[model samples]
Target: MRALRAGTRTLDLNRRIAVMAIVNRTPDSFYDRGATYALDAAVAAGTAAFDAGADLVDVGGVKFAPGPPVPVEEECARVIPVVEALAPHGLVSVDTFHPEVAVAAMAAGAAVINDTTGLHDPRMADVVAAGNAALVIAHSLAAPRTQHPLPHYDDVVADVLAFLRDRVALATAHGVPEDRIIVDPGHDLNKNTRQTLELTRRLGEFQELDLPLLVALSNKDFIGETLDRERGDRLPGSLAAAAWCVAHGARLVRVHNVRETVDAMRMIEAIEGWREPVYELHNTRPEGND
Candidate 1:
């Protein structure tokens, strides 16, 4: 995989896996409801995530699930401060589908704009390109802030890949450089548990696209349903899915639990031979004196 350059931060996909810690500034987000909704709380969470070894922090002002539309100004007010506070600490991404909000976020020191709407807003790419920011285009079938129950596809993985390819093309055409683009399969968004499972199993197929593949499968409904676990008890399942995605060619994993995901990814790196122990003494050869 090629390296991804998000403004000033460049992630070398070939040698390292990136863990994007999720920080929701929304009160009604699926996870962490109202925990970080306050500006001070959000800033603290972002700092905490960065200090915990996250390669990047993804800050979202609006919830992905169907809900009332958060006005562009409100969304900006919610996330821009958090982004500004965290950008100096580490790489930061603002998750929003509104073009105006994207522009405001970039101005507020965000290096990446993560649009979960799959670039549904035609002007979003232009706004990102103007700011010279990185773009994360997710695969969601429905419109932003809307519901699509029981969404169908002839072949889930193939369909997702095709949609991502087209979105990439659209983004590039709008002046966003190719190297600054990342693709996400949007696990659990507009997909059933079975479909999400298939996507995770076949995530490697997306490698053909040649961009960084980001999977946001942390504590999602699929894991809960698959393991019959509740929201707070899905860490094990989330980590398993993360490891599988990395093994299957995913370069980035977005999650709520940073420390656990960081540890898991490090273990994966060592097991896959991408990394080695700091000092291996258990099997070292004996010296001449010995």
Candidate 2:
């Protein structure tokens, strides 16, 4: 049985699937586009997600898209307040690849540092270990906000596995415990739609790593392109894909629609017998009390 420990919250991955709600404190988020950019709004949104069944909230101060470079001070300013406010409520994971940002957020009580860099900055492992926080080493071939047009891979899943394996070794060597680390395939990081789709279909391959898998597939471009739908219209596809990941081997799902994702995941879990129905009385009344 595997488990994830994040600050005050610990999740038993062997017993059930977990949800990590998204709280982007940036003005150009692909989904909300800064709707939750304000400090108070970000806190409120995270609080609502926690109430709706999210096991944790991922607070990101910057978008993963290319734009102006946000200074370290500015990034810390944006993330620290939200982390400080939300830490008391539930698990809080700060999504940033910068070692400086990781250092500050952990000091502010973030349980996990969801670094999308896959340890691009080696100092990240040391910084996270110093805080005694779990580290999410997301697989990404490109630097955050950079472009890798028409990226090619002989075998994308195999390539991702190799990358994650190397990063895991690096982290462990830095004194980060094996149990305190997580891995993410980074749905659309640098891959095209076809590659992302292939990755999704075979994400179970990641289970070989033997670490908790956290898949962030909410309203991503791959889903949009595959279904010929826009960002807002991709929930059904996102939910379906999330369900598949959960059924296969994803221990945690990072998502935008917390309330709805929780609903979908619980239903899937119930169907799979990992979760029990809230109540079943449609002819289940001792099989006779109609």
TM-score of each: 0.96, 0.96
Cα lDDT tens digits for candidate 2, 1-290: 46877765667888678899999999889899899999999999999999999988999998887777899999999999999999898889999989999999988999999999799989999988777789999988877678778889899999999999999999999989888899999899998999999998998889999999999999999999989999889999999999989877998999999999999888877877788888767776766656
> For residues 229-259, what per-residue lDDT tens digits would candidate 1 score against the true structure?
9999999999999999999999899999999
Model 1: how far is 136 from its true place, Å?
0.5
lDDT of each: 0.91, 0.90
The number of clashing residue pairs in each candidate reads 0, 0
Any residue pairs clashing in model 1, and if so which?
none
Off by over 4 Å in 2: 286-290
